[model samples]
Target: MFCRILRRPGVLLNQASARSLNRAIFTRSYPFLHGGPSIDKKTAQKITVNWLYHDGKTRPVSAYVGQTLLQVAHAHKIELEGACEGVCACSTCHTIFTDPVYDSLPYPSEDEEDMLDLAYGLEPTSRLGCQVTLTEEMDGVEVRIPQATRNFYVDGHVPQPH
Candidate 1:
């Protein structure tokens, strides 16, 4: 059913109701289905993210309110991995925030902290990407992705999107 729909332009699975599609794609029902929160250009809140990569490359991307860091990275095709998806089961989505923004975000949850322990290059500002949701106050945030990620549990393989 999905394949047939994909073969057509501007179509979705017939079994997928409007509400279901909105929930699954636009909202957080399945985090993997969406890279970031739905943004309405007119009234949408915008946040600027400076992503520092392992290659010493920096990319700036826009983030919408309520979207997680992992969402923005994935949306922008940055190389951070969400090995456990985005439920914080693993630290493959580890990220670090620059000083001001680092101090700006709320303290990490126990689950996030636990996962960070498994992340590579853990630092004082280290955080699980999936756990850092954007807010109005975080308009000019800067996050850095570690040079390498350890996903030994996933056999060291980072799955790519289809």
Candidate 2:
């Protein structure tokens, strides 16, 4: 009987209905699928910045609004060496972010990608700190500095605090 029904023309599976049903069922059945809380820029204030050093130290600080990651790091005296001064011309400021934050960011521009190709310890989540403009959604995110950068500086370059 099952084989006979499948052979009938109108009895075939309806892809459109099946897809809609699955979407509704899965979305409602799984709460995590709804994604976390929605973030609004107006309500998101006092972002807590995290700079994880190569030595396994976390130097947390407050970030100013409308500042890039590199700027925040520099302002806080973090060791991120933006050799090109946030121009995306060098990979000295390569930083790693968590998966969700990394995913939320827009794709890198051509210049940033060209520079990132030269970064050391590059991972899928690796990005140039200078190119990452801080947003409300990035609050409380950890920025992992790799062991080294392709630049001439050593693995741990300590620059003077501004």
Candidate 3:
């Protein structure tokens, strides 16, 4: 097995290098933010979103009408992870939509359902961010990033060992 020491403390040496490689590949492949429906700034409209971050911070952001939640998050540099690049291939972008907004959104596709099944904090209101496109109706919606999705290295919350 490949192994080495890392200058940083608290991170497992093995995981440090592996995580670095994965993050490189992951960030490089996050194409959802760039390529999407064209938006005209002058014509573009915005919606207010109350973002409940994983570390328990609530923030308000303006989002575009034609972009997915994941795209909005990435645009604002929100910490949500979309490992599958908004293709619905993974549940890394799992999020919760509060109240009437959750009911207003369309039903999840089979692919999204399957992915959400693997999510850490699955709830009735849970939906993958990649699958939920923002719309004018979603204005003032509350979107939450589950704490269950915290990354030990980044979020500073380590998971209990199984």
> Relative to the true structure, how large is the alpha-carbon lDDT of every model?
0.72, 0.71, 0.72
Model 3 error, position 18 (Å): 25
Instruction: Decide which is better by TM-score, 1 or 2.
Output: 1
- Clashes found in each candidate (C-alpha, N, C closer than 3 A): 0, 0, 0
lDDT of 2 by residue, 65-131 (tens): 5567877787787778886556565688999988988999999976677667778988999999877
Clashing pairs in 1: none
Q: Model 1, 1-162: lDDT tens per residue?
A: 434454466765343243333333343445455543455767878888888887788888987887788777777877888876676667888898777788878898765676677688998989888888889888767788987888644455645542
TM match of model 2 to true structure? 0.66
- The CA lDDT at 147 in model 2 is 92
Better of 2 and 3 by lDDT: 3
- The TM-score between candidate 1 and the true structure equals 0.69
RMSD of each: 11.9, 17.2, 9.6
Q: List the residue pairs that clash in candidate 2.
A: none
Q: Write the per-residue lDDT of candidate 3 for residues 29-81, one digit (tens) a residue.
A: 44445555677767878888889977778999998788788878877777778
Candidate 3 runs further than 4 Å off: 1-34, 150-162
In model 2, which runs have C-alpha deviations exceeding 4 angstroms? 1-44, 152-162
